[model samples]
Target: MPTPVILEDLQAAFPGWCIWRSSAGRLWATRNGRHLSQHEVDHGLCRTIDADDVAQLAEQLKEQETAEQAL
Candidate 1:
């Protein structure tokens, strides 16, 4: 699939996050408005996540979701 389509799907799947591919082709995601607390950060949450491809990005997003739910 094309990058735009992938990005659109990712955006829909993870609405709280802004997803896009950089000019250098690295996929990046950042929270739309929600900020992580210090505890969340200590538990492995990040303000932004980057990956080389969609699968990795999705995995990271899932991990973030899990971490958020755990809190």
Candidate 2:
């Protein structure tokens, strides 16, 4: 079997979610929990990344690649 995936691995792979800063120096799940930069979030790096978000991002990347190749 392949190496198992972990949360840190997901976090590293998706640095977009790393932009969030908590008062306690940790990640957050919502805006009230921590102040997230509007820019990063709009830029697709809000740091509120969840598993579903990751999967969606992967799908988007795949679609973008397919479109680029078709171009």
Clashes of 1: 0
TM-score of 2: 0.31
Per-candidate Cα lDDT values, in order, are: 0.86, 0.40
* Model 1 CA deviation exceeding 4 Å by range: 1-5
Per-residue lDDT tens digits of candidate 1, residues 6-69? 7778888889999988999999999999888899999988899999998889888988999888
TM-score of each: 0.88, 0.31
Clashes of each: 0, 1
**On residues 1-71, what C-alpha lDDT tens digit does candidate 2 reach at each position?**
12214445434543433423356644333222546456544545332432234344444433433443454
Superposing all C-alpha atoms, what RMSD in Å does each candidate have to the true structure?
Answer: 3.5, 9.3
TM-score of 1: 0.88
Q: Which candidate's TM-score is highest?
A: 1
Backbone clash pairs in model 2 (N, Cα, C under 3 Å; residues 3+ apart or in different chains), count: 1
